[model samples]
Structure formats: C-alpha cells, structure tokens
Target: MSFLDKAKDFIDKHDEQVDQALEKVGAEVDKRTGHKYTTHIDKGVDEAQKRTGEGDTRP
Candidate 1:
C-alpha cells in the first residue's frame, strides 16, 4: 500500500493514541502562543479527531 494507506491503517488501529497526541500538540501550540489562538486550535483538533478512523473501507 501507499504511504497514505499505511497511515490510514495505523490511525484506524491507534485512533485513541492519535487523538491524544493531537490534543497534546494543540495544547502545546496554544501554550506557546499564549492562548491567543485557543479557539482556532481547538476547532482544528476537533476536526482532525473526527477524521481519525474514517479511512476504513472494509465491509
């Protein structure tokens, strides 16, 4: 499979870990920016989490 496919499979298997990592990264970005972009960062994180395991095309 291609790199994107491999990434999708990995995310499908470890969605929770991916979500946690995204949250941690978002929080760090917010902290570094003095919370100025808190709302935007949170929205981005939410969007990313929503698409975590959606790549599964299995029956």
Candidate 2:
C-alpha cells in the first residue's frame, strides 16, 4: 500500500473529522497572520483537500 492509498483510506473513513481538522488548521493560520493572508491560506487548504481527493464540495 502506497502512502497515497493509505491516506485515501483514512480519508474515506474519517471524512468529517478530517474536514474539521482542515478548518481548524486554516483558522489557526489565519489567526496567526491576523487575517492578512486569508486568501492564500484558503487556497492552500483547498489545494490540500483536492490533492487528498476530497475536493472542496463540502458545505
């Protein structure tokens, strides 16, 4: 099993929690930067989710 495969499996099983973690991390980064790099941070998070095959389709 490759790392990507393992990650995909984990994502499939823990979708909600993973989403929450991503949101929290994004929020923390925004907070630390005093919301200066909000757009960049959001883009990074979206890219991360896309790379993980999760997409940005969640509500």
Choose the strongest candidate by lDDT.
1
**Predicted model with the maximum TM-score:** 1
Query: Candidate 2: which stretches are off by over 4 Å?
Result: 1-7
Alpha-carbon lDDT of model 2: 0.79
What is candidate 2's TM-score against the reference?
0.70
Residue-level lDDT tens digits of model 1 in 1-59:
99999999999998778888888999999999999999999999888888887532212
Please give the distance, in angstroms, between residue 2's alpha carbon in candidate 2 and its true position after superposition: 7.2
Whole-model Cα lDDT per candidate? 0.84, 0.79
Poorest 10 consecutive residues by lDDT, candidate 1: 50-59
